[model samples]
Target: METEPLLLSTSDGVATVVINRPARKNAVTQAMWVDLAARANILSADPDVRVIVLRGMGDDFSAGADIGEFDTLRGDATSARAYEATNSAAFAALRNCTVPVIAAIRGICFGGGFGLAAACDLRIATADAQFAVPAARLGLAYPQDAMGDIVWAAGPQMARYLTYTAGRIDARAALSAGFLLEIVEAERFDARIGEIARTIAENAPLSVRASRAAIRAALSHDAEEAALAQAAGDATFLSDDYAEGRAAFAARRTPMFKGR
Candidate 1:
């Protein structure tokens, strides 16, 4: 059976979201953005999902939004705003996922594609991957939410440089600028990401969620977010997983987390 442009699959507490439009270099269309948001939101609410890995099919991660649609979808201020809404919604879904979202990027990751990677909690890329934001060159502006993610990932200085210059940076440069967690050789990339995902999945779910929430709260410095993070952390202590964790530690066996 054929898959949609964006595909979601789950196994062993991990959900993998794939950008399936390899022919278009996985450049996302407006409809794909909507699908992405829906799928991500669903995954966020799924108790069985411990982590999410977002990646593109074939050689490239993504070249960014489908510019061919710009004439009809973003031709005017009103239409552009609408188009951006979908894009931001997709990014927000990934950003707000309860579990960590890792971007497994390869080859070209540019423009909105870069924003997508930024929205992820961590990014693992192939050594040959390239990153850029060509909004200026295209005479376009990134959505505010997307811009926030880019700035958060790259820091203000690096974000400014990329946006202003519209130049491409190699994987090493991206890693140095904080946009990537690490770069793996093309041959080992899939295996490395799978290992990382499985490692995360083996941990106590509540603990992972709490850590993510706490970190987000710390970074955002929002009172409400802090409260939410505190609540998540507090919940872990009362969870059955906590008991199992302690028991397994005492028994010197791996703890089997149930996400309770």
Candidate 2:
């Protein structure tokens, strides 16, 4: 029997997290969610990792949850809430990581898979990628945390459209809904994602981190969110990377940032 199949590997300052259940189109099990959260934490704490790429094995990305377990694990509201706790841990770990995350999507992304992609910092998919949320069909109400993630990526309106309709959307429509940043041809997908990830990895880490935090707080009125965003900016101003960036600009040479 196959042991847990989630994979995390880091190389050249970039970390790649792969969902390895291609047989199910990477359908996520609760155990996989726990493993994902742990791996994300490990990646978050690694100073050498400048960027993260999230992907799935085989021809497609994830097809969402392993609904087969619902009868045993999520048969009721309390049980479902318990099941979603793992999802919250995994997605929140990815979202709250200081480093940038890129979701490299190739094929189907449905239900929870769509939620995961939306939580990432950027989503780039192939032209053939498809997305949907089937909450309506299942007669399930999205918990606040999951709904908040959809709202954060798309918006209140698009989130409602997706949840209420339980309809499939193509890559172009997903892009228009703010669910995807770019859609490349299938042949060009790998090269395109590598190019983008390299660009982010080579940039000043502090500035990029600050930009990410501030943008996350852009529409938030919460005091804690405001304070966190302010701290990200303030810390960047005092970072050694700030000094190196300035000197490198003046000297007209590529600045090597050590993420100081």
Which predicted model would earn the best lDDT?
A: 1
In candidate 2, which residue pairs get closer than 3 Å at backbone N, Cα or C atoms, i.e. clash?
A: none
The sequence of per-residue lDDT tens digits that candidate 1 reaches over residues 79-179 is 99999999999999999999999999999999989989999999999988999999999898988878889999989999999999999999999999988
Number of clashing residue pairs, candidate 2: 0
Off by over 4 Å in 2: 1-4
RMSD of each: 1.3, 1.5
lDDT tens digits, residue span 39-138, model 2: 8888888889889999999878898888888999899988998988988888888888888899999899988888788779999999889888898999
lDDT of each: 0.93, 0.86
Output the worst ten-in-a-row residue range by lDDT, candidate 2.
1-10
Could you give me the TM-score of model 2 versus the true structure? 0.95
Superposed on all Cα atoms, model 2 deviates from the true structure by an RMSD in Å of 1.5
